[model samples]
Target: MEPIVDTVVIVAICVLGAALARRLGFIAPLVLLVAGLGLSFVPGLPEVHVEPELVLIGILPPLLYVAALQTNLVAFRRALRPILLLAVGLVMFTAFIVGFVVHALLPDVPLAACIAFGAVVAPPDAVSATAIARRIGLPRRVVVILEGESLLNDATALVMVRIAAGALGAAVSFWDIAGQVALKAGVGVLLGLAAAVAAAWLHKRITDPLLDDAVSLLTPFVVVIVAEELHSSSVVAVVVAGLYLGHRIPYLLSATSRLQMDAVWKLITFLLEGVVFLLVGLQLRDLVSHLEADVATTFRVTALVFLTLVAARFLWMYPATYLARLFPRIREREERPPPAVPAVIAWAGMRGVVTLAAALTLPRSANVPGDLFVFVAFAVIVLTLLIHGTTLPMLARGLGVREDTSAEDALAEASVQHAASRAARERLEAAADGAPESVVDRLRALTDSRSNNAWERLGSQAQETPSAAYGRLRREMITAERHVFKIARNEGRISEEVLNRAQRELDLEESQLNRSDD
Candidate 1:
């Protein structure tokens, strides 16, 4: 296919798949994966050459950057214990368990190759986990743990995979491998922090919102490229930079810059996510061709490997949660520890692009059966995507560990308080004018309607008063404001550009308020 035609086809598939996923109540990435699978069967479809470096460089930096930007660094810091246990400890545990099992089951395969397979499949895909977690209403803490794990574990896994591959290819020592992992991780962290601080400083100095927005758009790529050039982990660099800059973003950029950055990144995230999943599905043919064994043998080996992965997660999570509770810091810090957390974690082990990219990047000349390792990785990805991803919501529901109603209520109350505050401020501003009595009265009524006195009273007395009826009215007022702006622009009372800018600001404010509530 011509380059333009290929681009059009990819865009069409992504848009259609995203829409279909929403309509069918499934995640968009899953739809994209299925779409890619179908497209792979078409005779004239252009081949998607899988590149490992591109996965980390082209895809991961932006996605991780956005995720880091969205992540509440304060919350992450507070939940460090759980996040570390999951991100660092759990990943290592999973990798070792899978590696050991693979080596034991297939004695012919070299130990290093088995470990490589484990490393590739160890970390869960952040994009997939975030999409599903949001849909299923997973607790904020649970989502944080998942997100933190997804961000950092790849660094550890990649380091291990490279070390293992080296040992198999060249007779490297355990001491050398250990030293390299520590050195890489340490340097990567420093590189990431430095990049973040520099970018944030640069952003603060720039006064023009448009210029600042452009800088923010390019910041992640800068961090990733600089870190990788220095032989450090670009994934870690982008994530750290994202977290640091995101934490200081309010102070670093103007309101306009922040608004533009949020809007642009949201669209960018959607596009990258769609492209990653589509490419993942399309790479299956290449993976199949790389396997040395027949389809039946490959299926059997892959099935066993998948079972090992699922079992290991369950085994690890149960003990890990219990152990976490044993610590006073953890127990004191955590909210209600859902009894079904282990099961939820187990079911959430759906693998995606990261694993596929790692597998396909395996060195063709590496000794100890690189092809088998790729096949096993593919098997895990397919199993997790098809079975675990499909059943995760059901699992959460079954465990009674779905959305927490009380927490959501608290979030809603907080939102109502913020809206009430904003309304009061607007009312006070309008009341400053020498308006007529009727207008003043209407303003007062609106202010009273938006008040959160009932919520405050409930907080003090443990009363079960329902949320005030003002939320709907507040939404209506906002909608009316937007409609008025649109009409004014159409009537030439205001320029289209001005109206658009105002509308975007209002929409962003509304979105922020809603997210705060959630």
Candidate 2:
């Protein structure tokens, strides 16, 4: 009972914190972290210990899957080079440098254990970064790079963690680590592709949105579990499966199913991220109490490590951006991004739950001071979140690196809508030969209205457009209709089932109108 009650209270606090952040125009995760930290210092409050398995096995997969699902595959492919540089190459570089520095600072700690700690903090979680980017309308290319890096970096860091752990037990050679990487990558990608293909085939047959969403929800967990059992990178497997399925969803699933699945995933992600960030903050008291080193030394090392991590990312980003242009084909294919772009990318390296979780997973016998490593990781997360989360938007704006693609996006949307409307007109012509003229005309009007609304959105917004006015008026009508329906039901003029069915129709139409306004 106590456990259940605690869970409820925690979730309530997370939700409330997030709501407050939204209202105040602050980053929700950072706000939640600060709130949790304050709560942790309250006298008589129980220490909150977030289990690593709970994070690694339970929270991670779904979050990764959702991020992958939302990522534009085409954009991801275009940014593949930069993504790999940061996700794989920079991770290795940061790990080695941090390992050497940590060994120098704490001579008693094994190099392998130090490297493991480095691996624990190498990958930056893009959840917060992407959120800030989208909110501030940063360039789409930058967002793609951040999202793509996040999808794959976890796999790289986890692989490094495993190698370092092996080294702690026995000397691990470069060739051994290389072989493990190839094996894990090969197995994870293959299994993920197979799982996605099978799931896609199954989902196509399941027309019911609820059942389809059920399968969709289960896919990440299933793929992750199987990949883990097969000694592959579960993170890679889940991400690949999600990307594949998300790409195919438009063709494979019904519109209703897609809508339902999206809403479900968004809700799940919101709750999970909220809980994870707050829990991370609530851990401060326990981590500080369990520190194996003096508090002063622990904080000093943490500060140094945090600076090292920041410096390493900036050091890698510039070279990674400019050096890739050495090849003629590469130079011709990709334009050099402005220096500010790289600066923004480098500074957006905020760590999150994955780093803390990885630190907790470090082997007990790895000759690393477990509490110290955890504390450093926690401090890094806190510092990064607090500093980067607050300053990233300001930096991007100050650097004149913001996106101004509204006109371009509107034009693209209008073009797509015109093409869609033309196709629909052809389909209607082919199938509606036997239909009533009124019905055919109504369908045509709706199609034209949709296309026109999209184009109107591109026009100047000095006053309300016809489509906006229509949507606004129609919404009022829907409200009125709903009121009357309730009155009818209250007067026993209609059955409950009838009222519900009628309301559903109105709700769907109102939703369509609202979407058009966007």
Query: If scored against the real structure, what TM-score would every candidate get?
Result: 0.83, 0.98
Give a tens-digit lDDT track for model 1, residues 1-518: 58788767787789889999989988898888888877776786667766877887788878888899999999888777767677666767777777788788777667776776777888888878767887898877788888887888788778777777766745544456557767887888899899888888889899887888788778888887887778877777778888898899888888878877788889888888898888888876766655686777677678878888888888888777787677786678776475687678767888878887787666656346667777677667766887888888888788877666564566687677768778786867766687777877777665654455424433643533333234445567789999999899889999978998998878876775465344
Writing each residue's lDDT as its tens digit, candidate 2 over 1-518 gives 99999999999999999999989989899999999999999998899998988998999999999999888888888888999898888888888888878988998888888888888999998588888888998999999999888888889888989888778847755456657766897799999999999999999899899999999999999998899899999988998998999889999999999989989999999999999999999999999889778878887789889999999999999999998899898899889999999999999999999999999988875357888899899999999999999999999999988988989989999999999999999999999978999999999999999899889988999999999899889989999999999999999999999999999999899988878766
lDDT of 2 at 501: 100
- Clash totals, every prediction: 0, 0
lDDT of 1: 0.77
lDDT for 9 (candidate 1): 78
